[model samples]
Target: MDEKTGEVLGRVVVTQRVGWCADLVSTMARSLISEHWNTSDVGMLASGEDAEGRALPSNAWMALRRLGWGASAPEGVKVNDRIVRMAQEQAGRTLRSAQWRAELTTGVLTSWPADPAKRTADEWVNVRAAVPGGQHLPSSVIKSRTQQIASFARANGRVPADPFELEGAPGVARMLLLSACDGQQATIECREDDPSRVVLRLQLPVRPDPR
Candidate 1:
């Protein structure tokens, strides 16, 4: 049974009276990602574990639903399956992207420098080896990470145990990950009036007032 919507994932199929809208899709994706990121839910999702330490499903959306972090459509705006699917696709992509940073933070924590200001050649190699894909990463990236960790240590008087403890959660950009979404969420087609022109349409979530 699906915990979020209280519906069976495979058995029940409800038809939508209206088609999905690109604007609405964009709105929902933005809202879901923003909500997750702001609440540190993104970090939890990236960790692939709940407070109980149980392993979560590899799929981001499923993990979210399992954690009861599932999102909903905008109030007064009805959404269809395709719309929800698209939002899920965008959220999944964002969550997956965070895994890299999580691994990087863990690597840095495991290979903490004797001196953040100066990492010896051997220290450099150790840190690189500890991190996944660290060999290809630029020196600036690791240096920046070390600086962050150093700052945390200075303020707290103790090194953070992990990414969650170090940064709580990573922030995500507020844009639709259109490339990550399925064709049902967005599409591109040539304009009939002008062959040179093309139309790229996708959905977006609504944002509350800045105030």
Candidate 2:
């Protein structure tokens, strides 16, 4: 509480449904991707800025590469393939064509090229097929959460991009914390007074923000 204003500050609470730590995995993945892009670009898409100079609409290419994803370029796809394809298909063929190609790449990367409204359980299976892992979370869930955070970044001009930077009551926060967000981290611990009942304790990291 702020003594001067007698107002409460930010607070959050939620149930984990299961002690799966899905949220922790998610936040950490984003942080790793942001950090990877800060110093290096993984050449996942030949159409990206890394070496092949391929244009893409979003930062998802970075995320995919951080996950160690792999894919094969289709036959006949050439240098700057998305951009070239768009220009070849468009009669007017201007700078807007580049935009079209970017959108195309984003769409393909975001979904398994499946319509979102019509996606089913098979999508996760399909993702596992491509991502070199067993099925975990649904592809839609990851995409939607990313979009939610991206929207927050655009509106608030800030988003929590790292969990290692967060600090709170030291061991307490880190031991039980499952999801850390918005300069905050949370953990689930059995209540001391009532060990049978579980409570979520949200905390602000004890460390200073890194600029």
Each prediction's number of clashing residue pairs:
11, 8
Candidate No. with top lDDT: 1
Output the number of the TM-score-best candidate: 1
Predicted candidate 1 versus true structure: per-residue lDDT over 1-211, tens digit per residue: 3334465434222111112244455566667766665326666776778889999887655676678765577777665555566566667667667667878988988988888999999999999999999899999999998999999999999987667577653443434445545666568889999999997654332232110
What lDDT tens digits, residue by residue, belong to model 2 across residues 1-211? 4334555544331233212232232233334333333212233332344343445433343324334432222244222322222222121111122333233223323444244334467774554454422255455654663455455556767543431121111111112212212223444678889999996544322222211
What's model 2's TM-score? 0.20
TM-score of each: 0.58, 0.20
For each candidate, the alpha-carbon lDDT, in order, equals 0.67, 0.34
